[model samples]
Target: MNYFTRVLKYGIDYSYFGLLNILFNILYAIFSALAFVSFIPMLDVLFKQTEIVYTKPEYTGIGNIREYLESYFNYYLSNQLETDVSSTLIIVVGIVVFFFLMKNIFNYLALYNITFVKNGLLKNLRENLYSKVLNMPISYFLNKKKGDLMSRITADILEIQTSYLSILELMVREPLTILFTLIVMFTISPRLTLFVTLFIPISGFIISIIGKKLRKDSKEVQQQQSNFLSIIDETISGQKVIKSFLSESFFLDKFKSINSLLFKFSNKVINRKNLAGPFSEFMGILVIGVLLWFGGKMVLISETISGTTFIVFMGLAYNILTPAKNLSKSFYSIKKGNAAAERVFEIIEYNNDRVDQKRDVELIKFENKITFENIEFNYGDSKILDKISFTINKGESVALVGSSGSGKTTIANILNGFFNPKSGNLLIDNNNISQITKESLYKNISIVTQESILFNDSILNNIKIGNLDTKKEDVINAAKEANAHEFIEQQLDGYNTMIGDYGNKLSGGQKQRLTIARAMLKSPSILILDEATSSLDSKSEKKIQDAINKLMQGKTSLIIAHKFSTIKKCDKIILIDKGKIIAQGTHEELINSNSSYKNMNELQI
Candidate 1:
């Protein structure tokens, strides 16, 4: 109930449909009551209770109107030449038709208003959730499971929109209608109403017992479903690896086991949830039978309630039980929605680890020095970098040479502000990096990593993502500079040729060159290249290095050197070992002065 109440507040202020919805539902209840009340006259006609036993009319103002109408009707009936059965039959038929029409029209309008409220809130809620995901800090995504996050964005929010919204509307409207119907039943016979109320607690207890198992099973089903989706995503993305390793049957077995578990849990949840409907209706019919027997005996002995009155009272009692049975269903749906809402809110409520100050430093350009002072970082208990320090002048190229796991990529990540050092500080032109806004910091740096990220878009559009407003000629120029223009022009559509997901349609070298072209378009003050040419052949590497040399002109660059030729061209080379700088000098100077650099250089050759 707390979750339902909280979620409603999110929509109530955002749209006026909440107000409209409540108004129409109330109108629906009123008209439904009036429709049933119209039966009183019909029952009187059938039971011969419409004789003129007149009393004086006394009223004031608009309150006098009903008495006036009643007196007029009685006067007309009394003066009629004949009181015939055929005329009464026609009158009863007219009353039934009129009441049925009123009931349906009001019901239609109530359902219509609900459609507007549900779709409007759903639109706004999805938009807000998407905006929150995009604006949250990068660190927030690192600790989350992609499949569970996907479930929140796709399945859980949709459950809130579908089941939760429907249940909420029913919880409000049906209960009010039930209450009004109960009041009418009491007016007809208080003894019968009391007898009905005695079964209320018993029906509620049964519903509660059945629904108690629903939430736990619902949670389990949701978890298994997410795991299944994750496995599918993994298999699709790594299809080549799976095929190469010949583990298709192994993965299939794993998937089948997970699917079986999901099926079992889903059966449990639905079985428990679905019991509320028929079981509740059965109990309701039982109560109605009990009422009939007791009320029939009372009617035989009592003069106040005729058989016709008793029959109409029974109809109203059945109407009350209809909504009561529906109430049990709505409660079950709310419990299911509670499980979904918990997962959805978990993602939207996670605390982003990166904090921004009230105000941040803004630098239009880089001028002085970029310094890493005694930096340390750990991913949980495993330290990735330790007490590392380095500096780069405004317009110089510095390369870091190391084997795998020697912290080359980590340094590149730290420089691009993708990660924050756990200890010590980084400075740009003497101002602390933490003081700068992420947008401003990113404006001064560009990265081209080993994996070339490209969307499924035209080559022209892909490069233009570096700067959306970049002109066509500008894209071609950047492409030429990366040595991608010659190959791209050879394609059938030239720059307009579509690159598939992750640029799968292109070769490794071609994708890397396109990535380099994207970075070239940014024209950043600092460029960080993390083994960007590692996937290319020597021929492609040479072409890319030539492009890199041209691109690094007048820009401070940190190259995570994979090629011996590229390392020798840097103004200085730093040898890193175990997250620390063990040697620093020219390629020739290091080779002369440091054993580690000589060994690495010799190994590369």
Candidate 2:
């Protein structure tokens, strides 16, 4: 019930449709009761069992409603029966048919209007989850599974919609159907209605017991589904590795093992869920038998309610059974939906420790230099960087030469405001970078990392990602500067060619150059190249080197490189090892003085 209430919070925008549904449900409930009640008059007039009244009934107040209705129905029937009994019977049957028709029409209208509410909730909930995922920090997903998140957004949300849809009708239509029917039953015979009300609560209690464990059982199923989904996602992403390793049997066994568990879990949940309908029906039939035994004594022995009126009372009593059965079914559905709703809301409500710090002061421009003073950083208990400090002057191209895991990339991330140091400060142009807004900070910064990141779209669209406002001619110019223009023009559709997923259709060199083209198009004031050309062959590296030199002509640049040859021409080189700067000087100065830098340089040759 708690989960059910939380899911409804997103439905506030569709309250107008909810109101229409309620209004139509009220009409539906009224007609549903009247449709059954119509039999009372029809049976009397058709069978000629009821005595006729010579005079019309007088007006009465609400307290005597039952007596007044009976008097009025008999008065009208007597008048009509004075003519042909066949014609009167036909007229009575037509009235009953009309009542049933109106009952169906209003029921449909109630469901139709609520469709907007349910569908709107579905749209809003999915959108909210997607928006939350997009806004989450990169660190938040480090321990999370991509496929599990996908399942929460896709399959889990769908489950919430399917199971909880009955809740809308349960809230208004089902309860009111039962309420209006009970009123009709009481009017026909209060004693029989009294017995029904007592038995109803007992059945409802038993039904509640059956659904108690449903939520816990359903949560287990949902969790296992997310696990299998993660495995599938990981398998697809690592398909090349599996094939190259010839480990097909290993992955197959793993998938099959998880699938086997899922089959068991699904069967358990399905069997439990399936029991609700049959159990509820069985209980309803049992109650109907008890009601018949009790009511039959009142009609046959006591002779209080007329035979025709008792029959109508039984019809009204039976009407309660359908809604009561539906009510139990809806109860079980809500239980199932609770599990899915909890999973989806877990992501939506998750706390992101790395969310951008909101500050009133937004940095508007970059000037002078960037400085890191007494900076310290840690990844868990391990020290990633200790007392690190560096400075990059405006328009001065500096290079960081370090082995893998030497914290050079971490330094670049701090400089670009992707991370904050645990101690000390990072400043830009004498102002604290912490005080700077991330959006404004990123506006002046650009990165060309080792791996090329591209979307599944036209090459034109992918290139425009850096600056959407950049014109076609300027894009071509940028591509040419990055040495990507020649190959792009060779494609079937040139710039308009679809790159396929992650730009897989392009070669490694072409993809990397396209990233460089994107960074060039942005024309940011600061550029960080993290091992950008290290992964390419010598021929490709030379072309990219010329492009990088051109791209860094006047920008304040920081280059992290494993290849010593690439940083030889930089104005200054900082050599890092074990998360600390071991030496700093021009390339020639380092070769002449520092044996550590000299030995590392000679080994690369």
Candidate 3:
């Protein structure tokens, strides 16, 4: 489907609003033509061209209705003129004013109804983008920039909203205005109306050529916008790195380059889009000039069209220009918005192949064990985990310790279903992990990662995120067990105190402890700790390690830690090197038997 058509589908749910909008627009179109047509009688009166009808006209069929109405109106004018010409002129002007007022009222009503459809589409589109982002697997975002994704969700969607108004109006309002006006023009003089209608396709074809170029340029503008936004994101996130290396000039130059591209392409799109309005108006005026010459000859020489009627025909022709210019504007707008629409719909329609295809099996508990059998995974051509296998029985705490880039975190991620192994099976109590329903599997599992992840929300809310039904006392108890209760209570708002972005308001240890408390509150039967204390100092590490141990009690735990001290008490420790497990044993047994494990332990100690 065309990208614009796909976006229009989102408004289907607001059909009633669209129906009302179309109805009111029909009324507006009728009145819009009537508003200008009403002045024809006044013009006739001014020109002393009003025929005095002594007898009222009889009712006629639809074909002669225009002639009948004209005669009746002449009869009324003649009677009124006999009394007073000034009063009759005032009455004619009054009728014209009434038609103009009705035209605007119906136009306002049409816009009021379309507002519901417009705002509703925006709301629903934002929600769909957000929900898609949330459900999308971690691997899906590996090749995408966070800042680019942010731009698609925010700026590009806004572009779609602005263009959507033009689309809706183009559908019913503008065309109807032109249609009704043309019908009246045809009635006054078919030759002039045909002449005007012939000019339309030529004007449209010219505007279309410009629009085609604008589409390509508009895409470049949107892409450049994404590039600058990505640079901004990187600059903000790596500010410390840039400042530490004294490389502000390098980043500034980098941003300026992308920003310059954005500025150039944006101006191109804007300049081309602006051409549409003026060109359309100029074409309308050109056609109007031809009408004046052609119709003036008919009125004066041929005497086929009357002088007063020709003047009224000119008024109707001018009325057609406003809708003509707006329709052209809509054409250019859709061309530009097509780029943004494609960007946004790409995310919404992303094929996340990592989502488990077989989700019928429920994993309500970790009753027996988790077994990784012949697991193989890769990032493109580079292997991250190869033919790997390990197991952790229920209620047993197992640790994976390895050097950096040795696949410890990768293994933990695979176990957590964040990434599917290229070839292998992960089993929970003999049930294929990939087949387990995500909701049920997640319900039984909790993870505390190396970096403390907390929202900018109250302390109590952060802990209660995944476990919203947990009572306050249970939260406090969980906090106490994780060694976070003292610092949390020390804050002015206690549990209600707000944590800043990524919990930056708290110390490294406080952040880590709060994460532990959040995990403990869930009370999951299976827990995974991926270097929960790697960045903390020894003092903080000891406090967090104590919390981890307590959170692991009676729970089947998988720990990926670099600091061997944190996992020494695990039931089994697996040492991995270069995507392969070199040894697996209890810490004491590994220290006694494996020289690699012994050296790593000695080095850390």
Comparison by TM-score, 1 against 3, better one: 3
TM-scores of the candidates are 0.92, 0.94, 0.98
Over 1-605, each residue of candidate 2 has an lDDT whose tens digit, in order, gives 89888888788899999999999999999999999888877887766776688787777789887778778877777887887778888888998999999999999999999999988988888899999998776556766888788889888998898899657777789899989889878767777888778867897788778787888888887888888899888888899999999999998898898888878877877787788778767876777887788878877998877788877877887788888878888888898889999999999998754335543356676779888898888877988888888888898889998788999999998887767788988889887877777778888999999999999999888888999998999999999999999999999999999999999999889999999999999999999999999889988999898899899988999999989888898888998888898888899999999998999999999
Candidate 3, residue 416: how far the Cα is off, in Å = 0.6
lDDT of 3 by residue, 1-605 (tens): 28777887777899899999999999999999888889888988898889889798898699999999999999999999999999999999999999999999999999999988888777778888899999998887888988888889888988898775557766689899999999988888888999889878999999888989998998898888888889888999898999999999999999989989988999999999899889999999999999989988998899997888888899899988888898888888889999899899899998865456667898767789899999999999999898899888998899998899999888888888788889999999998888898889888989999889999999999999859998999999999999999999899999999988899899999999999999999999999999899999989988998998899889999889888878888999999999999999999999999999999889977
Model 1 TM-score is: 0.92
**Candidate 1 displacement at residue 176 in angstroms:** 2.2
Q: Output the lDDT of residue 482, model 1.
A: 94
Best by lDDT: 3
Worst 10 residues of 2 by lDDT: 352-361
Kindly provide the TM-score of model 3 when superposed on the true structure, using C-alpha atoms. Answer: 0.98
Q: For model 3, which pairs clash?
A: none
Error of 2 at 186 (Å): 2.1
Q: For residues 43-148, could you state the per-residue lDDT of candidate 1 as single tens digits?
A: 7666666556345455557857866765655444443315666775676668678877877776677677777777766776778788889867666678776777
Supply the TM-score for candidate 2: 0.94
Model 1 accuracy (lDDT, Cα): 0.80
